[model samples]
Target chain A: MQPEIQPAPSPASLAREDDVLEAAVRWRAEGKAVALATVLETWGSAPRPVGSHLVIDDTGNFLGSVSGGCVEGAVVTEAMDVIDSGKPRTLEFGVADEAAWRVGLSCGGAIRVYVERID
Target chain B: MDLALLTALNTERAARRAAVVVTHLASGVQRLVRGEDITSDPLAGDIEAAVRAGRSGVAGEGEARVFLNVHVPPARMVVVGAVHISQALAPMARATGYDVTIVDPRTAFATAERFPDTPVIAEWPDKALPGLALDPFTAMVALTHDPKIDEPALEAALKAGCFYVGALGSRRTHAKRMERLAALGLPQAQLARIHAPIGLDIGAANPPEIAVAILGQVIGALRKPAPAREAAA
Candidate 1:
């Protein structure tokens, strides 16, 4: 005998990072400026794994995630700057950042995010 | 940030081909490497190895710093039974990142109330399997004790080149099944692909434990190299 069955949650987010990449490509092809940010590395109890991504367009629209909201705002901010300057930059966030403290990741983890404009 | 490279990735994904996107961080140069087209890329060996393992990560340092974003089609599982084992296996398979579909013609067994997480197709395997598009990333399991239900699914799995195929049966049952399949013109090589006992012999006495064993075996067959898997089998 089996218990009452509940509908399983959709696993649509499994390829979310790839979706962001595809979206970035499409946005660029449409002549909209776009920047791609990836979690190149992480340490301690980081919320997201390495290779997590956040793709941002010029209008501030974004997709995917480099962190569990702990560092997306900062990454988005850096992403916009990268899109404007056409220069790639690396960002670091941990409990050390007061902003990170305000959001979360109070678990004391650090992450290295790289942002580059997709030309 | 190369549009060409990104476009290539999108194309490969659309074709359901596995690939890896390699990017050099400092210079921000990127290239898309499909598993089959690795020889054309300078980083052929490394990128192919990474994609085969289905893992993405950063390698090297300084100017050589490379990020490999491995991409493979999502894993899928086709279960040919709406029995108790499927009730346990479907959810467990979903938890293990498999897109599961349960196929059982018996409406009483293959109902939404029984397999809430998967698409329950109330059609025989021969009728339902073709639409599922079982591929290298798929694992097929025939859990129905009835040969009418399980054999057709097993045939479809072998023909489709599914990565893992298992059927629930005891040793004597499997011996009889092998005879029947052989008489049906399935080659020895194709018939060998079936893991007749279904799950790993881990002293599994209940449905959930059996499900775990089956999923574990499927994962092993998926993750291990073919030669190594042959040796283990």
Candidate 2:
């Protein structure tokens, strides 16, 4: 169906399918293990939607995106770790909560994701 | 490795299972709120709260219902007709990350070239369907208007328990189609599952627009129910 954007292999962007495929394909071609993280749902003013996906390769290489460049780096790093360990991970991004504040969620919105390795 | 991920995706779409998604926010303009990286404990952190605060999607923008679908085995879309509409739809459908198969008996029309990246089956419906292992997670669409092709494929789809079974046609065409389906011994109640005039009434005319409408309806039906307390399991 009339793609949301024009053809000719558009540049990568968060919340784009090509971005994910691009990263995954690149990683596969380069002989790296890759893992995929998909956004299942978003609440408040989040950047992406439920079906948004992000992929990362074992060498820390990555493609596609799940947020407004707010958390791709961290997500990619996490994906690499998940692939290395062979464990599925569910990550979260959201508002301020007491205790520990390691990951900064700038949007004040919440996003849930499921991460699994893809070789 | 890829197959495992696809399987998970299929499970969620087929069973409509609910699960939370976690995102790690980055530093930027406006707000910069930090939260505990509580995903370490596997079952740690308040999933509902985290998802809500993150604004996983545009909050409550459009009337689009959001559900945390756990793709148990991954989802697949079986397109019974390798027509132009399928060409437009296959990639888009893949975007939402559904495995796609284009089925058509026309050798010339159902070639890998027509559907560049999809699995194109140049065999008849009966021959093609039996091999696909149709499951509840499967979604079948008959884009070809030929009764010879669509009828048997649809019968197989109904028996396989596909979540969404749609056919490309107009309201008038659907009425006539019902007659054929009835003659084939498919009950009216069973026939109701078929989205005869498939796709939302977007008033689309072209192939791409029509494909969009069809995919939209398919997405809506396949997505898990909204957070209506009553519907929650």
Candidate 3:
């Protein structure tokens, strides 16, 4: 609880919930479309743990991460769709998926990410 | 997706308050539930369990599936002593995902040169630890053999209910220290929280090895719940 030295605030670093949530707040206040993709669950050798986030603006700009670098490209792409459709999409990717190697989730794990538009 | 909800959530985060952001996927609805408010939540049981474990996950099924994004404050380690053992333990704690702080009133020992890239507060633990707001997410270690320093810190740590309290000493030294603490009117149950003769009995003979043992025990205490004891009168 000691407010000591703030660690590195990178998405790939220790999960900084404040930074990501604050970014979402900033994006909304700016009137830009925002989508929040949260790692709902993980199985096997997932890179990032559950509750990780990747907040994406309509412009494809993002902060934080749900699956490290793996599957983020696909998530961002789906996030854009969610923004347009004003809907939520749950994306599941795994080693068994044909696109797993392409998306770099080749760590022999599966992850479910729920992407929802937050206007 | 409510702006008011997001605003409230950010406010709590700024205050370092524990909360869980429950997002219902199908309807794209989300609500921020704080610690005290969880009991009233429909998902109270799930949220409480998640809060206790400090983890977040999906709960329910089908359209009712909700993502419980837990927002507990980061775990911290407050090492009270700027000795070589502290120099070794601080970074190890940081590597293991703890916000590490070194507290020692001796400015010469608690120098930035000795512990770079970490906060070193030159204040007594009784004064400094209270301001740190030690909680269950925090672990405190007293490496200074001086009872004047270590005892005050241990008292503050135990009173604050830190997840782990460890003091460096031999069995005989701990007994003597306990006698002193007992004189201070701290009950036996409270003193039981201290893991004196500190660390797992790993036969560590050097500073670095002892540091490893300490971190190992701290991690064990954090990861595993303490054994149940008889209820206090």
Measured by TM-score, the strongest candidate is 1
What lDDT does the true structure give each of the candidates?
Answer: 0.84, 0.68, 0.86
**Per-residue accuracy of model 3 over A1-117 as CA lDDT, tens digit each:** 987896345333232444887889888978999988889899998989898889999999999988888899999999999999987888999988888678889778899999887
How much lDDT does candidate 3 score?
Answer: 0.86
- What order do candidates take by DockQ, descending? 1, 3, 2
- DockQ scores of all models, one per candidate: 0.38, 0.15, 0.35
Distance from true location, Cα of B18 in model 3, Å: 3.2
Regions of candidate 3 where Cα sits further than 4 Å from its true position = A1-18, A95-109, B24-31, B36-53, B60-65, B175-189, B226-233
TM-score of chain A of each: 0.79, 0.72, 0.83
**Per-residue lDDT of model 2, residues B122-185, tens digit only:** 9998898887878766889899998889989888888887877899887898888889889989
User: Which stretch of 10 consecutive residues in model 1 chain B shows the poorest summed lDDT?
Assistant: B8-17
CAPRI rating of model 1: acceptable
Local lDDT at B147 for model 3? 93
- Model 3 clashing-pair count: 0
B131 Cα displacement, candidate 1 (Å): 1.7
Cα lDDT of model 2 overall? 0.68
